[model samples]
Target: MDELKLGLDLGAVAEALAAGEITERQAKNASKFINQVKAVHEKPLKARLIQSDRGQFLGEAHPLDCGAWKAYRYGPEFRDGGKVFPSLEDAEQFIING
Candidate 1:
């Protein structure tokens, strides 16, 4: 996997800890930094409305916590209720089609 832009390889850190190549304290520090990075990158989840070429309002696409996208038809009170797609393109397609 690609190393994080912060120059921390979390997977490598865990592996090094398991292999006794780094002290527990060092691993803990790395973990802390990783969590900080996550906090910085995290965004509040908000659904954006999808529109068709003719300006017809589709439903919404939600960014899932697991790094997937979800497209849902408009439910009562604008609730999300649909399938998850691996990419935003797929989600948009589903929103446009279904």
Candidate 2:
């Protein structure tokens, strides 16, 4: 038998172990690792850089901004408190157009 050694190869093994075969310890560890990976990838959206007569500003490219813009533009509190967004497409439009 070939003993292939691997370091931190929990992703594949944890997924392949299946529900019945995975022990409590493995489940806990796998969940932790998976969450860590998720957090690492959950980077914030890029900020929009603008230069105008007023000078430069640091703006964000996000749905909340778009929602607020929409609300302000159309006179409706649609994206209030970050609770609602019709779609990212609408949000993205504001980001680009503004």
Which prediction has the highest lDDT against the true structure?
1
TM-score of 1: 0.48
* lDDT against the true structure, each candidate: 0.77, 0.43
Clashes of 1: 0
Clashes of each: 0, 0
- Location of the lowest summed lDDT over 10 successive residues in candidate 1: 1-10
The best candidate in terms of TM-score: 1
Estimate, for each residue in 1-98, the C-alpha lDDT of model 1 and write its tens digit: 12432565688778878989778887888878887777766865577789989998888888888989878876562463578899888888888876
| Model 2 Cα lDDT, one tens digit per residue, 39-89 | 666865443343334654313333354443221222233234222336654
Candidate 1 regions with alpha-carbon error over 4 angstroms: 1-43, 75-80
